[model samples]
Target: MRFTTRVLLLQLSTVVAVVLVSTAVFIVLAVEQLKQEAETSALSIARTVAAAPVVRSEVALETSRQINPSAGELATGPLQSYALDVTGRTNALFIVITDGEGIRMAHPDPGRLDRKVSTSFEEALRGEEVIAWERGTLGDSVRAKVPVFAPDSREPVGEVSVGFARAGVLDDLPGLLFGVGAAAALALLIGTGATLVLRHRWEELTLGIQPEELVTLVQNQAAVLDGVGDGVIALGTEGVIQVSNNAAEEMFGLQGLEGMSLQELGLPTDVIASLEAGEERDGIVVGDRVLYLDSRQVDRAGQRLGSVIVVRDRTDMMELSERLDSVRAMTSALRVQRHEFANRMHVAAGLVEAERGTEAAEFLRTMRDRGPVDYPLAGADLLTEPFLQSFLGAKSMEAAERGVQLQLRDESLVLGEVGGVEGTEDIATVLGNLVDNAVTAALAGPAPRLVEVTLLDDGPELVLVVADSGPGITPGTLGPMPAAGESGPDRIHGHGIGLALSRDLLRRRGGDLWVIDPGGGESGRGAVFGARLPGVMFPGDDLREDEE
Candidate 1:
């Protein structure tokens, strides 16, 4: 049988047993109470009869004469008529009266009169009243015995005894038992209903699973949570953490994660919201770690079991993706340079073949004077880092293709490469997004579409600014943007998501991105954005001192 069914049945049986026991106890007490009441009534009747002045005087006379009670003594004796009348009035089983010498003076059976009594009446003769259940010649009964006294003096006299039949004492037993049974049945019904309700509540809590099924479910959850490497967190509908695997503890650097809320976990705002919303998001910055997250709600049999979030540390992957983009861009730039070099070589060769030696030499001199074919940016010579040069070269080519001019501001200078492993990924991410945004905005503007980037190494911090000669930005457009997924192309077209993630990354390192100038859409000026990236410079590359 089902576990719930067995539990309910057991509870119901307990209720039935209790009710039956209670009902039986009540019925027994009821019979005893009735019997006691009958005894009390019979005792009162017997005492009243024994105290009568006629019986007292007559019994005293009979005692003085020492005469025997005659059978059918209706003409000679008041005792027999008196006993008969009293018996007729009260429904007692018998009203036996004994003389002082223990001889019966009156009895319900006249032929038995003037005979020795079968029941004991010694306490009554000694002036004590007695009430008890006893067996006599008539039958078993609850009887009362009392002493009859002389009218003139406090002297010993004959005794009077009264009794009620045992059957009569419990005459109302059937009705009393019926009432008790009815009450017990009602109680049992209520108890049964309560048990049913409790069973339903238990089933709901366990989702109607048996005990063994519950054990299996727990084992499966343990296996899955332990086997997975990605961080997994389970939250209840009320936003409390229900389960957090070991990977989650390690990933979030928090122990004892269960029973905590999102507020208590102290996760990044974007990450917390994404988890709460059960959405998929990537590139969330947490303590210098770029994280990707996917959250889904758990449901079973149409019941909501809250949500589960899977977290992956994507910091290394982001850095590698950036490196690949830089390589691809450098390769493209080199290819363009190779094609241009070949064209110049053809011109020089043709001139020499035509015997115009002076023209060929002049062309060669001009080519040398030009220094490099890769100066799409104004301050390209300032960047001694090969990665930065190639990256900027690629961005400039991209912007130019859309009719926008991209430039490295003349004041920008960097004496050493960007920071070491610590902040390298973060710096690259923020810088890439900012440059791409500036280029896109410049391309969309009216005329003189130009984008400028200024990078300065200040101590161990890289402070950079980007400005665009576009329609500019409205201050109101800035707000908390939602987090979104990022792909390999470096999130170029998604301005809002890119900007939000960039600001978040810098902020994680005690730096920030902000609007230096909200922009001038109607005026000739453009929008300027600035950022500070900490730990992005190799310590004591100390090149800021050179510019100073």
Candidate 2:
């Protein structure tokens, strides 16, 4: 079963077991209560019938004669006085009397007057009070018997007994038991429903949040690593292959080596030894390319669990560095050639001076017409050349055509063309977009529109600013932009369509875009867009450092 299913079943089983145990306990207690009630009701009915006045009088007359020999005087008559007192009273259940011989003298059934007594009467004659059990042959009755006494004596001469049917008490048990069973079943159902609801809520809270979630989170992280041009591998607590990205697969040629140890995945000997020794290893090459590998043990809550190894492809960067070194050599040779050319011009000027004034004047005029405009940076390669100056000249011309001025502040040392490892084209794209937007916004205003562009190198930051004097951005577009709607890109739209793309590019290179001092500048109404690229330098080809 799936892990989630197993969890749910385990929880549900516990609920079922508890409900069953509770139901069993309830039934046991209920049955005991019912038995006690039945016994009490049967005893109460017996007591009521045995205490009737008619039954009491017969016992009294028998006791009187047995005590005082003259008690026969009262027994010999029609028992008139005794019958009168017995019949006048109210609240009697069943009244019955039996003579000394165990024959009935008075009963609710007239025909039963002369009937012989049952064994219960004989037990009463022996002075023992008796109660019959429920559901016997005598019509499910509870019979209570008491010996009668004469008026003056304690000796018993007659017996009085009363009985009530036991069906009423016994019949109630089924319905009562059925009601208890139904209630228990209902409780169980409600408890089950409650358990399901609680369990479902718990499941939602814990979904994608277990140790398994951590595992899956690492898997997603590996996928991101694979998405990039980098290799990543993770090891579990036992040094097993926990995760491997596609780049790692290709880098180590282990595409089908999942679940294998790092030592078995064609890793370099040093890397494998590092894994065996449980020590971090870095900067190891596995294939034909240079790799910047960083390995460290994964830890949480101060406890070491496993290891993670990140391998970045640095081959291209190393090649760029080598190329830059070669170009620097070429630039040195070009500088020598330029120095020789200057010497040759001076010698020619001296020769012209020695020959005549007219030739020297002509030579100087030609030189002046054909002289090189001093560029701040120069090299054969496009990246090593002074591209910044060219870029600024081009943008300035475009802005001038649109009746706008693109000004660059020369406060900080100018950063020459950077080309060693970073891609200048990407940086140009970022700068070009900002400059274009500034020019466009500036042109939207009246003539004499101006866009102030500033570049500075603050410590650890390269700040570029493009502020435009136009109808300032609408207040409606100052926050995060939503996705596109039916309106096309040409129409006025939300923020960040251009800004977000520019920001994303900068972000990938560890740079950022922001609105700097919106209303703090000389023109309080214009917008100042700033891009900050980190670790930029003036003399080196820093732009090339971000190529990868």
Candidate 3:
């Protein structure tokens, strides 16, 4: 059966069972009360007749005679007449009077007059009253026997017995049962109506699903949502969080996130707005992780059913991409050097093969004097560190490819090894981004396109500055940088994450990136970007400082 039907039937059955049991109990109690009331009435009438002055005097005189009277002798006497009057008024089965010899003085039937009473009267003879159900000549009845006393004494002269027929005691029971039955019927009707109303409400709440099905759905949801590696969040149409997986909770650094609004969860306004607009956003940093967000509105049969968001962390992928770009740049630079060397080797071989020994000797001497490849940078020859030198050479070639000149400033110096810093990769990331942005900006300028870089390692800090010859950052456009690991608009360097990610990396290691000069003016100058890495101790710098 459908769940609604089962619920309705169960409720109705429970109510009917309760009403039936209650009705049975009511009937039993009502019958017992009726019987008790009958006994009380019988007892009351017997006492009243026993106390009558005329009946008492007649019985006393009869007892004094000590004679066994015959039937019809006192059939119309005062005692018999009084008993008949009492029985008629009270609707009793019979009222019998007996002398001290246990003979009936008056009976409902004249033939039974002056006969011994069938039921016991010993207690009544001893001045005690008795009331019980007993069998008599008339029939079984609730009978009461009371002692008759003389005019001035407490001694019993005769006894009066009042009996109500068994049928008469329960005469009102049928009417009571009918009333109880009516009440029970009315109660069952009310209960059934209530059950139907509740069933309707249950169907609405469960969306027409049974209790067992709801339980299974909950179990399946838990298993599927928690078993996934990617973060998942389900939102209601009002942008309230209804469900969140373990990955989402851990990624967002939250717990018990259900039933909270997106605003309350402290998510970026951009992210929330994007979700509300049904847009997909990727590489949005949340906490210390970069996450790619894919969201879609859920609808079924043209009904809006809120939305769901899936998140995948992209921090590792971004780092790998950066590393790959660096390697690719280095490889390109090496390939260029290899090509230039091969050309030089060919020239030398051709010179020697032509027997111009003096010219070949002079060429070899000149090649040793100048380096392998003639670096186009003016001040770049001052840099002796192999890694920084090679990295810059690669970047210079890259900048030249884009019609921008990359150079090292005359004052640029690394007193000690740049790689001795705690996070050299972070340093590389910061410089690499700064140079790339400078080159791009320079390429957009009027003439003399140049990106000048300076690297300095003061004892406790590593300072880097990259200046471009392009139109500088507009005034008031260089807003505060995004906090570490927090995603923001792509405003720096005209739509690239290089500056933002580079700044984030630097900030993670006690450093910061900032624009020193918003250089654009009537002169249309370029901007200057700088960074400072604190506590950047070089290898063996302590010994060098002690010697100094």
- Candidate 2 local lDDT, 124-155, one digit each (tens): 66766665553422455555566665445456
Write candidate 1's Cα lDDT for 296-334 as tens digits.
999989999899988888766765665455456667877
Candidate 1 residue pairs in clash (backbone atoms < 3 Å): 419-536
Ranked by lDDT, the better of candidates 1 and 2 is: 1
* lDDT of the structure predicted as candidate 1: 0.76
TM-score against native, each model: 0.79, 0.43, 0.72
lDDT of each candidate versus the true structure: 0.76, 0.56, 0.79
Give me the displacement of residue 256 in model 3, in angstroms.
4.2
Candidate 2: residue 249 lDDT (0-100): 79
Angstrom error of the Cα, residue 458, model 2: value is 9.2
CA displacement after TM-score superposition, residue 300 of candidate 3 (Å): 7.6
- Model 1 residue 386 CA deviation (Å) reads 5.2
